[model samples]
Target: MFWLLFTLFMVACFSAGATGGLFPPGAWYRGLNKPVWTPPDWVFPVTWITLYICMSVAGARVALAEGNGIAMAFWSIQIALNALWTPVFFGLQKIRLGLAVIGALWVAVLLGMIALWEVDTLAGMLFAPYLLWVTIAAALNASVWKLNPEQAA
Candidate 1:
């Protein structure tokens, strides 16, 4: 049951991550005047991979607990929002929309974290790093939007 639940959650994370492959940040992103705090290019994949593992483990733990209905729902919402941000931002070249999407993602992650905590402390703990990453991502998205008004959509 643990493996099965882990597989399902991992698949959900992987599906959301596939958007990155579909709409990669190419020359446009590279050319942007990013803030000094922007992370190096290599940081994204590594951070996401680690977050995915934590997210999947969190979900798996929650799935095993009783009365995890709300937590699971929040989990689904966060993953869906995660899948949307890439396409809207990179594919559509809409930095403003990206900010909105990421903002919602941040909220969903927060709610998911809280709800997961109620069900399983370990599951909630796993989301702490994910929330931190999303905080950074949201700041990055907002910074990019502010820095590149001409590119706003």
Candidate 2:
């Protein structure tokens, strides 16, 4: 049962991850002015792959736990926001909107982390790296928006 739940959660995470394939950051993103701290292109896929695994494991852990309603809700919210971001930012080329989406995602992840903690300690711990990654992603989004105000407009 736990393995089945884990697979389901992994499907959800990868489904959300599919957005990246659909809306890749091509020349437009390459041309944009990014901050010095921007992560190298190679880092994204590696980080996301690792994060998705962790997210799936955490979701699976909390799925059958008692009092997991809030955790599950937050999990759903975070995944939806996660899927929305790439389309908005890369597909639509709406940097400002992407910032908004990522900002909301950040909040959802933070809440999800806290809520997951309430249900299972290891589940909550799993989200810690995800939260950190999102924080970096949010900062990257904001920096991109700020650095290219003209493009964002």
Candidate 3:
């Protein structure tokens, strides 16, 4: 059961990380007017991988704890919101919608973190980076929306 659970956790993290590819090529990203402090493109994949792993570990911890069904449900919702952002922004090229989704994702992640905290502090801590990353992503998404108002929708 432990191995099965671990496998499921890994699959969730991997799938979420890889969802970036659902977007158009990085070329489209390059064309955007990014913030001055935007990290180099290569940094994104590595950061997201680490963040996703942390998120998965946190989620798995909550799942392993007693009476975590509600926590798990909220966590699942946050993950789904996370997964949808990349496609909405890059795939569909809907920056405004994506920004809105990302904002909601931030709130959902916070709710998930709170729920996980009830089960395990370490689980909540694991989501810290995830929360921070999404906060930054939200800002970036908003910046994109601002920079290209015409393409926002």
The lDDT per prediction is 0.95, 0.96, 0.83
The superposed Cα distance between candidate 2 and the true structure at residue 111, in angstroms, equals 0.4
Ranking of candidates on TM-score, top first:
2, 1, 3
Q: Residues 1-153, candidate 3: write the lDDT tens digits.
A: 655665687788778767776674467777888788777778888898788778877877777889998889988898788888888888887788898899999999999888998899989888888899899989988887888776664
- Candidate 2 collision pairs: none
Give the best candidate by TM-score: 2
What number of backbone clashes does candidate 2 have, counting pairs of residues 3 or more apart or in separate chains? 0
**Stretches of model 1 off by over 4 angstroms after superposition:** none
2-63: candidate 1 lDDT, tens digit per residue: 99999999999999999999999998888887899999989999999999999999999999
Worst 10-residue lDDT window, candidate 1: 144-153
For candidate 3, give the lDDT of residue 116.
Answer: 91
Model 2, CA-based lDDT: 0.96
RMSD of 1: 0.8
